[model samples]
Target chain A: MVAKRTVSEVGEFGLIGRFTEGRVQPVSTLLGPGDDAAVVAAPDGRVAASTDVLVAGVHFRLDWSTPEQVGRKAAAVNLADVAAMGAVPTALLVGLGCPPDLPADVAEQVAAGLWAEASRVGAGVVGGDVVSAPALVVSVTVLGDLRGRAPVTRAGASAGEVLALAGRTGWAAAGLALLAAGRETPPGPVAAQRVPEPPYRAGPAAAEAGATAMIDISDGLLADLGHIAEASGVGLDVRSSALPVPPELAEAAAELGADAVSWLLTGGEDHALAATFPADAALPDGWRVIGRATPGAAVTVDGEPYAGPAGWTHFT
Target chain B: MVAKRTVSEVGEFGLIGRFTEGRVQPVSTLLGPGDDAAVVAAPDGRVAASTDVLVAGVHFRLDWSTPEQVGRKAAAVNLADVAAMGAVPTALLVGLGCPPDLPADVAEQVAAGLWAEASRVGAGVVGGDVVSAPALVVSVTVLGDLRGRAPVTRAGASAGEVLALAGRTGWAAAGLALLAAGRETPPGPVAAQRVPEPPYRAGPAAAEAGATAMIDISDGLLADLGHIAEASGVGLDVRSSALPVPPELAEAAAELGADAVSWLLTGGEDHALAATFPADAALPDGWRVIGRATPGAAVTVDGEPYAGPAGWTHFT
Candidate 1:
């Protein structure tokens, strides 16, 4: 039988080595892991950056979500933010907090998630610090490159531009609903909720196609789009009929007695790409035109007040 | 009379706006807050990055230290890591998790600390995310520029190289001991534990001097030096009498029945720069020669085995 090793036995430095060993870094990275900080090539002379923190019992649960899921989601959410800037992710630094009793494999799983998502975005988990916490908390910071393209901002949308989405919405919310139902899962909506596969490439694609304004659908579709509207000083109009409710969402909503339309309009964490393009520009594949940028400050849907849920507000 | 609003009153967006208002961004940053991610100039074709997370009870106590202290400590630690990579500080991304009932002033103080420390390193807090948690946790990610200098790593130390240190050691541990002893008002050593002043410029100076290997003594002088020895496959010999023990540490150690030399050797949080230099190299002004690198895996003092504390180990 193998003797069990505790973190205290090896110490933080030894454990850090165990957690970071075999991790590959990009060629442009001058340093990785074992140094004070990791250096990565940023030849573009600019970097796009963002940070997100996930707390246990709020953002995730140890019982419901595996450590790998928690780690992936923690990293994926931050990467999505960077991608929303119309940049390619280059590197990430992670701050992890967990109880002392937490298994070493759990930490490794979290790292696995971070590694997988980072690889998906053509980036690497370059550097990080791990410490003890009262509860599991994962904090991730992403550094990205614009690759010489203009960054799409929320304040650039002009009147008459087409408001569109390039990724699926309401899928994660539907997954949540399924999870709430306590149904043993398979390849279903709940699974998607566990791991949100963001429309990572669409951000750069939109930048390439001259997208004027952009934001990620983390805080519901209407709410985040509203941010662009307010920042750009423009009005937004959504055709309610244009809402893309995944079939799984309709099924879950029907079973849960929740309105699927509300889920499509206000549910968040789908990581769908929302942006405004010049009316004359060609639309990219998988993108659906859902609305138009107008000359007011309000967000309207289908020329009427179709209120189910507005959006998510922090500290509410 | 206008009533001060709680975070719940205006909600998350309003709080974010308040935090971002009156803040000026650097010219290198193309985009700031209120966006999906912040865009900053990363000239030199590369970016240096590091991250750290500080928990309220474990890392900092609200009763003992102000929120600003927490913020400064949080950002300072990450920035110190970046500085360790022989890079110029550029920008920071922050992730904060707190309870809904946390006062807005507390958040402001934290932000003020973050901004103050960031400015000290010639960088700006470019973007952040605020979320709900059961406890207060601050995570900061810093990005830096190498300015075309090759990063010095721990693996490059060679036999016959002189080991030198560029900052004080054991100050924080002395402060911590004072704090634990109910000596809340320790004259100098106490504050040192609250906020360590790392020798920020020494890293770049070492890089410019073509130092072969480097590390920041965050986890005690001897413990962190052990990292260099293990990484470079060499033995190190430390001199007890050469240690730069602050007068306050010596005074406090006497009262606590501890030896200042042991603390100087094994205490941590000094964030001093330690490096291995060629035998014939000219040493910088601030650096002091404390040891020599030799072929082997052992670390000794004065050509003999020195029985002393081995420094801190996490979860131990």
Candidate 2:
């Protein structure tokens, strides 16, 4: 049997060539990898940009996820940020740091995952840098074209607005709970945890449908909505009964002796799009009306403050 | 004295607020930090992008350089990449990872350094992310505006073109050597090592002057020139006598029994701009003739292959 080669053995340039060689780029990528910088088309005269960092153990454990899964998560988080701004993703620049002893295949798989996720949204991996570090660190920066629309910021929601959500929520959190309890019987939630299916088209659709405010639900429904409430100086309330609870999530929660509704309200990482539209505005397809914006500055559930965990936060 | 607050004590949001709050952005920044993503003006209808990652031990040692200097270095390296593409830098998105125990002030200083350097080029720090990790990692992505000019890539040089250089070389290498020898007498070189001064204007200037090929001298003169040579299918030969050996570098080398010319030929991190132009093209101010492109594919010094170490490379 052949021994697996480490990243150190392949060297930085060699590893970079392996990851980028012969990969096809989308039309938006005017100049791809092999240059000092890449040129990406932003025909709307403006560009939306975002960055996200993922660290090994802190963000993902190799034992719990494939290197590819980690890469997909990294790209998904940043791509979702771009979509939340009502923009179409155009290009991605990746910065990868790896331990010397890490297998070269792991790094290649991570790159493949990033490319796969980016391709799904018609974006290209245009440029990147590879270096040595104590642990695996993947940083992704995404660029998007706004196509002549104003950005839907967290500060734009107002009183008398209808709150809506696009895509699934709580499934990732339930999957995490299942994993913690050493049960993987329900592959649905576990798969959601591994790779999120963010409603990418719903973002631009919401913008076209006159969304007043928007944010990707990265830190759970209640916690992320709290951002909109505080930024827009309005009160937000979510109807617990309105949130769709998938049968798989409910089954997993029942088996784990947990509350599915709580997960639906407070669980995160599904990369769902949560947005606010005018009371009279028509919500986009797949978007369900969940609640409304009021005249104060607090986020509530069923007209009362939620009594469970708020969501994910870094550091403490 | 009051105890310094650690990053974990401040929490991720608090740390981010302290670093980004009240900072002024340039006109190109349509939306600054605190949003899911930033909107930056790209009036040229295209954006040039680049990403670079710096690790704590491999890229910078806190003990040898101030946190602010380290941050400046991080920003400079990436900004230089954008400049090398003959584009005007418009914005920066930083992804920072830190140990929980790292001082909050240290992190703020790092952000300040990044802002200072970015501000020098009239660019804005538009967005970023802060996450917890085992060590300090700074990943920066910069966006640039091409202003209707074609990107000056490494693949355009041809035989019979004159090679020219803008900005100093060997200074940073001398500084690193001085520090390694436990002697920092020459403040110039030591400072250069801490924060590189990339000639930001020279890139576009060279492009305007009709440069056939260009590259930022990050991995040293010969090594980087080799990139252009290979990509453009030409050979590059540098005359040793034409390379500048700054007086401070020469004095430091003399004291340390080192070769100043070798540093001039092989030192990196100065981010000097090197380009090949039509033989009769008028050189821009601050750029001096150093070599010429010739037939074949080898990078030579005074018509012979260099026998010393080439330049820096990550991993092995």
Candidate 3:
């Protein structure tokens, strides 16, 4: 049998060809890979953009998560950021740093996963660069179209607005807890942790329904809402009883002797959308009312300050 | 005296605030940093985008270049890619991975350099993410507007066209050679290696002048021209006598026992724009004709194959 090839053996240009040769591009991709730069359509006269970087040991472990999973997470985080702005993602540009000794197949699998997630929302993998580094570092930049709608920012919330959430929270945190405890019997939480299913369409739907403010829950609910509260100059109060904690999380917490509610409050990386709407506005499908924007500057759980760890802070 | 503070001491949000608090954004930045994502104007209904990843020890050595210079190089490279596509850069999004122990001042200096370079072109530093990593990695994504001109792609070159160049070459490579030889007497070459001054306006000028094909000479004159030859299915021949070998390059070459002509033909990273124009077309200002496109495939110097190293490949 032939020896397995490393990225060094395939070379940079060859590896780029492998990643882009047969991929299909969406209509928004005016020009795809294999050029000095890629051209993407932004028909609304504006483009929404965001960037995120992930490192190997700090953000993920190769032994615990597959390269494909890591790639999906990278794309998901940036895509969710664009969606949080009430935009439809149009294209993704990746800047990947890899060790020379990494298997070619592993790098290709990572590209495959990026394409998979981008294609899920009709976005194209437009362009990328790969270079040798000390460890794996994935940097993704996503571009989106506002479609003639005003972007929903975190500073639009007002006091007396109803707080709402769309999509699951705390499941990824529970998965991390299970993994840290070295018990992975329940597959749902672990799967959620690997590849988040962000509510991509809910952001625009909420925008059309008159969402005043919005954010994606990459940090814990309290910490992320704290951002909204700080930016909008309004306080927020969450009713703990209204949070939907999946049964799997409760079961895993029971086995681990951990509080599921704490995970729901402080765990991050679930990529759920949270927003505030006028008290009289209709809540969109898949969204449920959970709290209200208050008159002071603080994030409270049942009108009391939360005492658990706040949220993730990189480099800390 | 106050002790030095590391990035970990500043925290992610604190560091982001430090980088963004005092910066001024251009008109293209509809919404600047502080929200989940930034919105930028795309007046022509399409945006040109490119990404490049620069890693410590691979693309740069901290001991050889200042953090500020490294940051400039990172932004310059991606900006050059957008310029090569005949577009005007509008915004930049950075993805930075830094070691936890890195001094906060150094990171601030890096941000300062990025802003300095972007502001030169009227582009805004729209958004970014910073995370903990084993080594420093700067991933920059630059977005540009086409201004309604069709992009000058590599595949448009035709036989019987005049080949031209619009910026400096071989200077950065000579500086690298000087640094490798442990001599710093000539400051010009060393400075060129530290930061490149790409002829950014020349790209759009060439497009407006009806350039048939164009590429930035990031991988040396011969190697980058080879890309155009392959894409456009033509042969390229450079006249050795017409190449401009600057006096400083000749002096550096004589002292280092290297051939100055070879450096002019094969040195990379000057970010000069090389393009093909119709034989009867009036070439744009700052551009000089140096070669011709032929009726077959191959890149030649003095009508023969180049025998030295062609260019760079990251993994190899």
lDDT of each model, Cα atoms only?
0.82, 0.92, 0.91
Better of 2 and 3 by lDDT: 2
Give the native contact fraction of candidate 1. Answer: 0.86
- For each candidate in turn, the TM-score is 0.95, 0.99, 0.99
Per-residue lDDT over A1-316 for candidate 2, one digit per residue giving the tens place of the 0 to 100 score: 9999999999999999989987899999999998889999999899999999999988777877899999899899899998999998989999999999999999999999999999999999999999999999999999998889999899999999999999989998998898878887699998888788899888888989999999999889899999999999999999878887889988998899999998899889999999999999988797999999999799998899999889999888
lDDT of 2 by residue, B60-141 (tens): 8898899999999999998889888889899999999999999999999999999999999999889999999888999999
The 10-residue segment with the lowest total lDDT in model 2 chain A: A176-185
Model 3 chain A is weakest, by summed lDDT over 10 consecutive residues, at A177-186
lDDT of 1 by residue, B39-104 (tens): 878777888888888888877778767888788888877777767777777888888887777877
Model 1 C-alpha lDDT per residue in residues A150-215, reported as the tens digit of each score: 888999999999999977777777777777778534346776788888888888888888899999
Q: Which stretches of candidate 2 lie over 4 Å from their true place?
A: none
TM-score of 2: 0.99
TM-score per model (chain B): 0.93, 0.98, 0.98
Error of 2 at A55 (Å): 0.6
Clashing pairs in 1: A41-B45, A41-B46, A42-B45, A42-B46, A43-B45, A45-B42, A45-B43, A46-B41, A46-B42, A175-A189
Best by lDDT: 2
